[model samples]
Target chain A: MLYREAGQFKTSYAADQAIFPLAQDRIGMAIILAVAFIAIPAVANEYWLQTIMIPFLILSLAALGLNVLTGYAGQLSLGTGGFMAVGAFAAYKFATAFPEMNIIVVFLISGLISAAVGIVFGVPSLRIKGFYLAVATLAAQFFLLWLLVKYPWFYNYDPSGVISAPPIDIFGFAIDTAVSKYMLTLIIVSVLALATKNLVRSHIGRGWMAIRDMDIAAEIIGFRPLTTKLSAFAVSSFLVGVAGAMYAFLYLGSVEAAAFDITTSFNILFMVIVGGLGSVLGSFIGAAFILTLPIFLDNFPRMLGFEISVETVTHLQFMIFGALIIFFLIVEPHGLARLWTITKEKLRAWPFPY
Target chain B: MAFFLEVLTGGLLTGVLYSLVALGFVLIFKASGVFNFAQGAMVLFAALFFVGFIDLGVPVVLSAILTIAVMILLAYLIERLVLSHLVNQEAISLFMATIGISYFLDGFGQTIWGSDIRRLDIGLPQDAFVFGASVLGDDIFVNELDVVAAVVAGALVAVLAVFFSKTKIGRALRAVADDHQAAMSVGIPLRSIWMIVWAVAGIVGLVAGIMWGAKLGVQFSLSLVALKALPVLILGGFTSVPGAIVGGLMIGAGEKLAEVYLGPVIGGAIEDWFAYMLAMIFLLFRPQGLFGEKIIERI
Candidate 1:
């Protein structure tokens, strides 16, 4: 009854076509915004902020990036870790080389670098499709990973091969605290996620979906395969790159190249697949579900009083995780996005069997 | 020159082992367009499952038989559970689903078998006989196992070729691979065919796991070894078994040579990328692969 939309008729095109056409969604979003921005910060402890919240936010950002390309445009990438590494290394270089520049600017610049690299690598997608495209991206995965590992200059010739974040600040605010980092990430992720949602609704986004749904049909409909596909590659990499910057800056605080291995790529890809391909909110939900599960599984034995080892719990988590993915695919191959649609549809058809 | 010969032999041996895993991938891809990222993971699972069964005191032959049975069941389960729903989905979703399946399998293998690295010695003759500095050792001083693996793979491919050519079920599978709807219309059991293909792929993975286990022991690396096959597909094409075998040998030799001759020049780590680099170069130049049919996109 509360979800009823019968009385929400619009009087103008601007109002009719506006995002969140439903009045309930607007309020629901505002409440969610209030909690994420206002209420949660006041109550949540530091540990929650540091581990779960920060990592999920950063990964969701990365998934959103992948979603734009893989989900919207229908190109497959197996080298997200490679691109993320580029962003991380570029951001590291920028932060250290020009220490005076704002860290946010460094993030944007890193994304630009990744976009450039992404386009270079993405050029092959014009000719390749499906599994072939995935293989081509692996070239980027190995080559970029090798560059990060081999070249000493990228890591400032650090003997340890790990880079550390120099205390990030914004105009003298001293944003080192987990709370501040969480807030910063939340703000950036929200804005970008919103922009992405909007972008998907726009012409380019439609073009991407057109190409994704059917390339030949899209071509006949006057879409330029080259520019559309390449731009998807570029924009998608940019979003993923910025997420990489955040991941480097906020999550690990300091890490090695192994942090962005193929497994990491697969992990994010899994999140996108599970959360809902092509849905922005699904990215956040998927990231949260995948990332937070291990912790829950790890704590389960303790709760049961069996006193299981973390390693054993981890192993069980892996097995169950596999079963879960198959379960989700079997149950809902469209990911969580389908769940959302189902929910809305149910709401629409409430109290009637017709 | 002796070193070159040694490298060639070693590389060819490695290629033979890799061909086993690629065999699983190519078989599934040919039958079903879904690129089984889980092939490597499946190899790891097979290796572990075999070792686990043997270590638990099952007779070697019995363990192998039991493992084959389990694989058949696993194949049917995956087809019924995961793949039936994904029959006509986009490639990306299916690919990611397989990745999920890989993660699940990795976790599943680790969980059931425990995470410790278990040695999988299925009693394949390990004693080596040396002919001067050149060694023709054991079931594996590179020569014996190489011949065995190559021959086994060849036999398997020949059997499959004949099966697809001679058998009604095989013909049905080929029809489905050619066009799913038409085959379905002609009353082919697409579900059962998928299950059979997956089961065969699983069995191929079992053979591969054994060979690789003899060399490296059962470890997580078996899954990563699936990396070699991506290039094989790029070299031979996804749809061709002979292409897969030939491509596997080429990459195995190429990666080994790169590791030996090109490693130091590129700071000593070419194996990870040599195959992929080769694939990318081929993709740029040929895109269709040597044995692969030309991919013509309907404009």
Candidate 2:
């Protein structure tokens, strides 16, 4: 009965269209935000903030970006890593060149640069479709990585080819500690996630869904394929780029172009797939699941009192990861988000099946 | 001119080996409509199995036969476990499933066979055969192993061509590829066709594994050749056998030429992305590729 929405009537169009129409949902979200913003920061140690929460939020942002393009627009791209590299490099250049600029502005500009590159790569999607388009995106991945690596100027002629993030000073306040960095990432991710939720609920998102379902029919219905698809790319790349900037500046502190390789792209894609396509909450859930899996695998054997070799554990990690992907796809192809929805539905109908 | 000829010959030889890998991809795609991203992993697995058996004191011939049996078994397991369950799923899901398979094979293969790079010696000559040394007072050489690879690839292609044309099972495979419902209605067993195709693809992977393993030691990175084969598929068309061979040759020669002639100006190492760029540009003009059938969409 706690989950029932029986008396929540929509008195107006605004109320009907509210993101959380139910009182229970609003309360649920408030509790979650309260936990993330207050409780965790107060109780959790530096290790949890640094190792788990920070990276999880950054990668969740990346997965959300991919979800917008591949999940929402039905455009499968393998070029996410390249776009992320663009963001990281651009942020580095901006932060160093103009030290006075606000750090958040620097990330936005980096995201904009990534959006431009994404539009350029996304041009082929108009003509090519399906797996063919996916392969075409690989051109963007390989070419962008090569371009960054080949030009020493991109890294400011660093000898090691790895670029370090400049210090984060927002209005003369230092964001050096793990908690500060975690807070910074949380605010940005939460804001962006809220904005993305609104964007997808709007007409543009409807256009993307229409195109994804059937491009020909979508075209016949007067949805301009060019703008709809390209806009999706721009928005998706923007989110991903900001995430990449955070990944470099806050999480890793220093990174090379090689850090955003194809494997990274695949990991984010896995997050999108496992989390749930086209769902904002799914992105976060997926990122957490994928990120924690290896850690769980590593520690589980030790907890059982079996001393497994590191190499064997790493191999087992790969095998189990692969097997789980298949298992998830077969059992629940829609992903963990669908399972969550099912649970909520059951809760609403608890103790009475008929 | 002599140096150019040497580079061209070397690239062409490498292209032939690439075609060997791409051929396996074509076999599965044509028969089962699943883009087997795991083909490269399958290659590495076969090579690892072959070498692992030899390390166990089995003779070379016996090891080869054992690897073939294992590949066939792999084909059956993949069909029964993965493909059968995903009968009418979207193409993207199937592709992702293959990626999962690729990861499993990579970890499982390395786990069983050990991750150390082992040299594969099936007695192929490793000498450079020089050509026209006296005519121009300059030497142009080619790897003898590469020549053997070309000959072996040619023989395999010829056998496949005849088998496809003459065998009853081959016709069933084509039928299944053409229209699954029609083929099944006509009593052609869809499951067996998929298994046979996968097994045949596995055998092709074995041939490619042996050739590549002998050239470069059998190791984890051997699976990365799948990335190279992708551009070949894009150029030649995913569904065409002849397209795979022709596309492989063009990419091989094109990348080598760009690397040797254009590398210095661009700080070298352009080979990594050259084939993909070429294919991407080519796709702009012909999305269906030169040999692929035209795609017609219906609303």
Candidate 3:
């Protein structure tokens, strides 16, 4: 079988502990990366790159960030959009304030700033849990958005209150085209996804899993709740913030504070939930599904020769989305990621039932 | 001072309306341990159905009856379709499911009724109730509709309070709230209790929908009122009905006062985040909320 690992053997601890220990997994990842970095860019149109691919990559990164906290650390946060706004605004400020700086560094600094803000909001999680903590995160979501809009300084006092991404001139080479933007997002997302995969597997990730499974037991086992929880928030926010920066600069090119509203937060949460709460690969799958669903719905009716109104389609989209969430939860509570895992497991045992 | 009183009174009245929404949330959470995030959507759906029926030239009374029946049916469907399957799941899972329900209801309601704003008029007086005109040489006005809302909310609370204490089914609901297994052992059917509680919550949603719809006009934004009720829930305790009323009043008055007194100092529109911030601060001291049962976690 193409997916079999029968001949593959780990010779050492490093090989055993590898993220993609199986030869098949490594090959699959290589194919995926190659497709993302090469094949898609070569064949895809501007609209696919700009409208679909860019947002998909950026939101996948955000969903990954959220997965670190809510999925791994057991802290349910609704402040993703807030943290993302912080990143976007911070990136805007850093980019404009230091025009000569590299864009990647600008995004990193913005993420750091978002992490700090995330920590401040995450403080309440030390005391509150569950839906109560979720509500507390909404304070961050609303207040941060409010701050961005209320103070024009965040937008550089633009009368329109929308911030436009400055041109990306890296070493005097302009990276402005959709392919270049998609490439930038793709590279960053790939690297971060790799980092997140490792981070979640490390001892810190074990600490997060411990806290998530049972905070009291985790605490009793010498995991510091404060540091573990706050670190998760910090790391999660950093990733989300970076995504927000990319979203503003690469995907949308111009953004307002309203762009990162509660709805945005919920969508990211949905991505995490529907994808697989605790899986790194699930983040991408979930993001892709959530992003592509509306487009699929819009075109499906046309393909079927049904002339549905856009308004009705939009309503149907919501109904289907909701129904799907419930359906997914009931049928496979672990999400699409779990389904993928099951498929792979079945493939490993295919043609022989023991 | 007169203006301050007007704002305070107005906020308290508005708070009563918030309590009405929060009450539905309390009913579901207490009975079934499911935080029904769809409560707001239920309100919107009920109001939309009522208004939609009326727009079709159904008499107001008939429309109200039909909407009530629809809400009860909705409760049954939600219980059978959603809650029953999700029984014994983690609280967060149930919460997420309710959010899904919220989305479905929002879309379903809008799809059927059309998403445009519809005016809901059930002959409630909309004139301003004037007071202290001669005493202060200036009239202090309270909207008559708000007064009706407060009275209606108060009466509903009283009825619920008595129903919970005196009725046989209500005691079963309380038992189920306490322990699902124990309640089932006591010959109380968990599913029926859940269905009944959801039905009751649905009726509460109808009342909230009617009042809020009449005031704000039946629209999609009516669903956002659920967000406002969240701070009230945080302040009052998720499980306590009386706590909802008190919490709603506090949040209603606190946000209004802050918006009025502090709006000039800071730019305007402080109402949006003020209640949440207040609730957040309150949560630091009492994570269980003012009236919520103490949370005791076991390792």
Candidate 4:
């Protein structure tokens, strides 16, 4: 019933151009914000906030970052987790070295660093496409991970070969509590998601779509392939970097090289493919759906009162996960985002054959 | 000099093992364009299943039969369930599907066996033959198992060569690989050909798995081993049978030799990136791969 946009038509061009053009969509989004900011902190327990939701959100952001490049821009990247590692390590170093810089600033700077790396890697995409390009991106993943492992300076020469974030304070408010950390992440993710939504609707985003549609035609039409692709790399990496910082600071707290391995890259890639390739909101839904399903399934065997080993659970999870991906690709190859859109459409026309 | 010889010999042994695994990937890619990233995982699973069956008191001959049966079943499953559905999808979609399969197989293998690395003693002799002043034990040797592995890999490659040239099923598979629609119109059962190819690929994986599991133990290590095959595919064309064998050996031996000789000079364990680095060089010059068919660029 609330899905109806009838009789609430936009009067101005600006109103029509707004992202949530429908009045109900705006209100619905506001309600979601209220629940997330107000109700979630009140209801969610510490472990839920710290372990599951926060990590999911940060990963959602990273997946979103990757989806823009791979899904929207038609570049396949298997190096997101590596870029995230760079962000995490960069944030760790920034915080540790300065000890005076604000944590928020540290986070922003990590994204900038990742953006630079993204541009460097994006150089290859101007030359390669499809499988060859993916292999090149895979090279980046291995190379970056190797660097993080070997270059002692990245870890500040810590013999542990891992980096840990010290407790951070945002605006003199200590973000040590699970609630506070969750709030911080929620705020930043909201702002970035909003920004990404706006960015994708803008002229530059159009340029990206143009390139995705046909790079040669885009070039003939005067879209600079180099600049457009590089900027995509930059923007995409920056967001991914911020996500990594959060992953290190909020979720993992301390991580070894294993956290950002090739599998992690694949996880982010799967999230995008499974979530709904080019859609921003689909990234979050995909992350939530994919990330939560296994845990839910892992618990299902036990919750239903079956005594299953964790290893078995892990195995079953993989099989189910694999099947789900294939199933999704088969049923709605566009991803969970497309599925959501269809659902919303159905909801809008509920009880009406039209 | 002795150490060099020993390293070289060891490298060749490992190289042969890698070629065996890479051969499966090459074969699948040849028959169908799908790169079986799950080859190593298939190896691990097959090996695990073989040993697990034997541990259950299945006779040696029966265990081997059951394992091959399992692989053949797996091949049919992929064809019926995954590939046929993805026949019209893009390369990236197919690649993504394979990634999903890889994860599923790895997880499935671990769950069944409970993640413990099972010791596989297939009643094969564990004695070593010595070369020169240094002794190379049979367990690690170019001994009975390794010799068997080498001969088996070579024979399969040869058999595939003959099968492709002489057999109807082989021709059907080739026809489908060349153009699915064309093959279908001519009455070649596309689905059956895919099943045959995947089944054959699965058997190839089983052979490789037995050797690798014997060496590494049947654990999650299969996925990592599979990663090595990517570089092999890069060196040999994706569709080349002999190319896979040759490429796998070059990588296997090349990585080991590099690690042994060049490790101390430039940190260590160059094996991780050696194949990739080599693959990248090949990609730059011969993007279709060493034995890959020629490409015509079009919009």
TM-score of each: 0.94, 0.98, 0.98, 0.92
Residues B1-299 of candidate 2 have per-residue lDDT tens digits of: 77888899899889888889999999999988898999999999999999999888999999999999999999999999988988898777787788889989998998887789999987989999886664356688999999999899989989998888899997888899899999999999999889999999999999999999999989988899988998899889988999988988898888898999998998788999999888888998899876777889999
lDDT of 3 by residue, A205-321 (tens): 999999999999999999999999999999999999999999999988886888899999999998998898899989999999999988898899899999988899989988998
- Interface RMSD of each candidate, angstroms, one decimal: 2.0, 0.9, 1.0, 2.0
Candidate 4 backbone clash number: 2
Error of 2 at A17 (Å): 1.3
lDDT of 4 by residue, B262-283 (tens): 7788677567777776676667
By TM-score: ranked, best first? 3, 2, 1, 4
Which has the higher DockQ value, candidate number 2 or candidate number 4?
2
**Candidate 3 residue pairs in clash (backbone atoms < 3 Å):** none
For model 4, chain A alone compared with the true chain A gives a TM-score of 0.97
Error of 4 at B192 (Å): 0.7
In terms of docking quality, model 2 is medium
Best by lDDT: 3
lDDT of 1: 0.85
CAPRI-style quality class for the chain A–B interface of candidate 4:
acceptable
Q: What's the residue-level lDDT of B36 in candidate 2?
A: 94
DockQ (0 to 1) for model 4: 0.47
The 10-residue segment with the lowest total lDDT in model 2 chain A: A345-354
